[model samples]
Target: MDKSIFTTNAALTPALGYSTMIGLGLFSLALAYIVRLYLVRNTHDFIIADRRIGFGFGVGSVIAVWTWAMAVMMSSAMTYQWGLSGLFWFVVPNGIAVMAMVPFARILRRNMPEGYTISEFIALRFQQSKVATGIVTVTMVFGIILEILINLKGTSVVVSTVFSIDWRVATIVGIVCVLAYSYFGGLWTSVMTGTLNTLMITVPAAIVVVAVYDRIPGGAEAVFSAVGAADQRNLSVLRPDAAAGFGITLAFGLLAATVADQTFWQKVWAIKSRDVSRTFLWAGALFYPIPICLGMLGLVGIGYGLVPSDFGGDIAAVGPYIVSHIGLPLTLILLYVLVILAACYSTIDGASAALSSIVAVDIVKRYFPGTSESKLFVITKLSVLAGGVIATVIVLAGIDFTTLVLTTYALKTSVLLPLVFAILWPRTNTIGFVGGIVLAILIGMPIYQFVGELSGTLAIVAISGLTVIVAGLLKPQAFDIASLKDANGATSAPTAGE
Candidate 1:
């Protein structure tokens, strides 16, 4: 619980942090524009990269977009707070969330090959009921907004801490950089930058662990001893406290969260069909090391006698605090900068693309049907800009990032089961999809806040499924899956170079 040990050390300074931010930011932005010159030419290219994305970019997109700053920072914080078992609880479910998307991605591509957003598919599915589309649109929008806001908060806070810069300044610089690259190619920009980000995070993370190994008081053995001394179950995968508190809840929460994300769904439509399953599976497997490796900072902190309790409930500081004290060389300090920036930028650009896709396809075109593709493309770019600006405003307004994310996710669990069932089950009707989600939002959220996350999430998902089942029994409206072939206007255009 003492902080005096870190006071004398200086791994990085404000000037270095600022230099890294501007240099990396400009380089990424310029690279995005250059890639855009070769790829982006139409709305089709912007939204889904002309549906020709290959295995490498697809896997990179999956890994990078999903590796938000919260994952990078909080996983380490949780490890510091809860011990070894904490890594398993956070990492496994996160992977399952992406892996679970494999089957759904294939199904979605088959059913709505030209789909712009999942909300677009929902609209096509329940043509007679506007409520379903409305539900999907509203939730997905809020989800993307909260997604961007939280990552921005995480990035700015970490950058501010390490660089001794103003959080507001860090946020503006980061958002502007994200907005620049994202404006160039939309989804193409996201995938390109994401690929770069994946390399940035993975290599640096591996290096940091190896570099810091000797700094631990007694090495791995000492770290393990401290872990057990803190709590024996810290080394076990089945920590009772973790399971009851967050393990199961977070698992289901991430499942719901990923299912409800437009960013992942966008990739589902973007990747080539033959490669969909492989891409998702590879991403799932590769994504594990990011959070797990970063978590060593926490374990090493434990070995060095700095635990979460020492930070006075702000466990988010544990990662930077560890790095600051360990006497990291200049190279490792710069490497740490890339890890954080990449984590934040990847998701930020992905969110921009996802929100713009929805705005252009679902909101703008749906409301103003006569708009031309050229006009829609312009609107989409503007939406990307607007999404970045709005999230920045929210972060600057001083909202609590964690609470905003939790609130957005609480709404998603209410609708997740019905949304999934709507895709998989023939008996799911508009009545159930609409009414169940509505009631769950009204009722389940209160329970989530006052009762418990696990109980509330389970209750809402059950209520949603039950409502659909009951509606099917009462007045079944059989849906024709064959109709989905024509659902997204027409068959998708051929892939680039096909």
Candidate 2:
């Protein structure tokens, strides 16, 4: 491995960084315009695409939303730091987490066919217990906000690092670009743009991975030798050390992220019922190669003996660092940037779309009751704009990407068991559901922040799970699940296609 390449600070010009952001933003705007011109006529079309999305679009949207910028950066960083075990721990749970939502989505879509948000269902399930519904709503809102912040933060860090642009400028540009399109077509735009973004992410990623490996002096074997020499465990797929450190934490945390998130739930309603299971199954399968390909860059970093210091002491910067320093052609470098930007753009728009659903159905409609459909429609778009502004402000505050991700995961994980019980178990009562989440937040969050990640996550799941079970046993109440059919009130007439 040549150490000399590390000395030169090679980077793309700031113009390229700004241009990429502007270009993607304009592209998303075009998609939104098309959607508005033809598809989005009301809140239903805007929020959930009239609940008629088919398999192709559904699969693409799922893959795009699931491929967050953090997934690209962190997958490599984990492998770079913890070896193959790190990649295994991160990638396996991630794919499975999305697939795990299949049963939940199937049941929820069947039971509450007209539902728009998970929190809305929680309200109905708990007999509209304000405390229980509020907990889930707040958890989801914060989770989505964190989703926006993390993707923005990830894009900013990568752009600034590889293009010599200021992180603040990158952050603001990324959010504004996403909001420009997301505000117009809502979920319709998100799905259309998300499918395109999926292509940008997957195709470019495969090319870059092969290019990097081909460009290496000793090729795959040399890279392997270099990595193995540093630490033999880097070659092992089943390193017990990584399983203990990353396996348990990511397994539970990632599952919580998918199940508790309104993003997946929004898709549940947006997609056709028959396509739901297969869409998720294919989406999960399609998602595997992305992180796997990106994780190889972590090995490339190790092969070249690059350390965190080379990338400003940020492990999450490993992917960008490799792409910039590895001497790839200028075209491939730009392609790599497109991949990151695409991941960031797709997810930001997806989260914003989900946020709009919550605002329209859960908050504004629920509270204002008499608010007209026209007003509800307008409020939904406005909520997305508001979310973009809030997320941008927080990103400018300079929070660490890893810290934001872990904290958000912890918060989401706290509600995992309680939420699952609410959806699946008839005996899950309001007292248990509400009490479990409250206790998890009150107790588990402190441990998460102050104690260990694993311990904190475990504590949250344990506390919430125990509370729900005990409450159910003590005060067993078989909720009339059939009544949930009318939970969202009178269903609107099906749109033209449906």
Candidate 3:
């Protein structure tokens, strides 16, 4: 059995590896929490970190959030399974997503200076109170479930593969740690831990890329050339393969997300200034390319005969397979720990904190007013624990990866685009918002069911069509913006710009 992860060596016993990993992962996480409580707390400190993150913190946290295990593993699967064409869905359009957000940062920063959440901005813009509540609830609850599930499965596989643990137990521990640190210090905990997790994520990913290249003969070019000859269309955008042919599906998902989702907006809102936000944009833009690089490792592994021909070809399977085949050695024990830590907690904590913030800021506040910031922070921290537990249970309850990915970006149609229009354009009313969400969901479910899941790009297009058509007919129920913002007890800005 392959026990050690570097050079030639015997595998560590699964039980021993699993135990060590769990113990180690927990230790680092506990330390991260302690750092947060000692050095970071206070609502402002936790929420936005005094709005002056060092480039290291900003860049690392930004990259950490984007490099969820699903994106890393699945992107690699694309390379191994689909070749260049897979890169299009996995990388090209995703690049466009990063690009799309850049200008979006300008608009968001300029318009809603005091906006704390995407729902807050949207609720004020549309003068519809329900929309804010609905958007936050959907994003915080549904979004996190998918995020949690993906991280659990993908990270657990890494934890198991690296430490030789059973994926099931690893997932349990993974979810628990994610919640613990997140709840302990909230975003403060997330950011502090994100710095370490950043190193864990980047260095190992870089090393693996090198290792895979060396393992597969002449490295990247050879792998690309071999796969290119095997399937030329796999390098192209249009493929006859009924699934993942980046036509309407990819386009829809992108459009829906670009116009609709609040997470990006919330991040944009959180940045210190337009220049800082602009600088922050570089983080995601720079980091997204890493996936394309890491993905090539899987392609090389496939070419070198490590993975099978029909290799399940999702985001979840590629990396572990490559890592599994590497010559094991005792020297790699520390490196292996770093790789799993990078994979497991980096995004998990951010996701937990963000989800908690949404619930505490959006859901709880809606039902009750006069919420003190300190109390709200406490509630958010507690919600982090609860959210992690929920995610863990779902993973244990048998939610598969495919389900998570398919449902993840559909919210663009459901909440994002409509909300965006509601904020930027006056025509978007409560009726229009409701109409748009219903239309988007209706179109989305059937297509996901039969025509194959639409990409974020395609989802946006379909929902936009449905939303615009319905909104014109509804003729709009006007919202009172002043009253809406006042009722929400938000920072009332001057002319929607501070």
Candidate 4:
């Protein structure tokens, strides 16, 4: 592919990119301050928003956290590669993963209403077994770190590509901006800002999509025909290549990403109990269009006969390439940058908040029973700062996005079935839960690297599930689900009104 054919005559100024980051940072900081002053009374309110978030914010937060940088970039990249099939395979599992959380959220919330982290729930469920708790806590921590790293990486890639700025500077600015707000308001900051961020992402994205179609010759139909003429497989959603490339890997990987990620679990407990299932359902439904629309840009790239080299040897840059090169007005181009920024900010803050929950509830509260509430609160905020620093360091290391994503997915997948068994099945014991994750990590990850994604993912799930079953049958010990209610010794603080 001739990269010169796709070169843009104009690019965004570094001034615009840096100013946007600084402006959004100050705005988020102000928003967090207001929220803290008016809504937050103590550690509980800061960490989980007093477990009273309503449907609107709940739905918005779920969508924002799920939207992250990878979703924005990968959806388009996949479509650029596999056409309609890429969009189909990438999007279906993405939505399904969020919706799948419904039942689990319902069950866990009813049983343990004061839960702050999944690791905390597992600790209680497994009767305080150190091995089980340690495994889950480590995974949750790792998951949040990966979330932060990926979002930072995503934002850096987009900003640097469009503005011709250094990616390292973009990453540093991005994480610092997010931490500025997130460190103050915690989950409250995440949910409230996430609601606003959702609008930032969707509205601009819709306009960009319409503008792109209007600008192209003969509109959507012409693009469709161009893609089809290039390759019939591009138009077919059920093409073998799409399924082989994205279907199996994303199906399992995305599912694990959602089910195992603490970001969703934080929302599960933060929202009103009655609103849990509906929020997830609505969020999942609403989330479908954002990715699908952004991904069309990939199809636009394909129709234009642009390849990875056209986007600086990175297919993930295809979305930005089409937006910047297609002769859209400067205003629309900036709005597209806002879309990427919003996605990155919401998820980074959300993941940081989730990490705070784990540090306070799973590690501090669980291990240091005598810690004061004031100290615990400070530690929680510090955790966000610590997470941002750690993720920033790793992003500076310049790891491959796809490799990091797949590896995180595999690690998360190793524990998914075990978590499910622990939640819904009474016979699921610590031995089974611990053993399942241990064996999956030892056996499944190597296969993932050496053999194939589909096969390795299947092995992880099967090994984890089967290990739980065999252990359960050999040593049938039923856990009392109702006991979880009393086991939840969540520390409370005064409400804002109190």
Local distance difference test values of all predictions, in order:
0.81, 0.87, 0.60, 0.86
Best model number under lDDT: 2
Tens digits of per-residue lDDT for model 3 on 219-266? 667766766665666556555452445434654555444444433444
Candidate 1: how large is its RMSD?
2.5
Task: Give lDDT tens digits, candidate 2, residues 308-411.
Answer: 88889999988887777778888898999999999999999999999998887778777776777777778889999999899898879765566656656766
Residue-level lDDT for 19 in candidate 2: 92
| Candidate 3 wrong stretches, greater than 4 Å | 1-9, 19-39, 217-225, 232-263, 305-315, 328-337, 371-374, 399-409, 455-460, 469-498
TM-score of each: 0.95, 0.96, 0.82, 0.96
lDDT string, candidate 1, 358-380, tens digits: 88777877778677777777988
The global Cα lDDT (0 to 1) of model 1 is: 0.81
RMSD of 2: 2.2
- The C-alpha local distance difference test score for the whole of candidate 3 amounts to 0.60
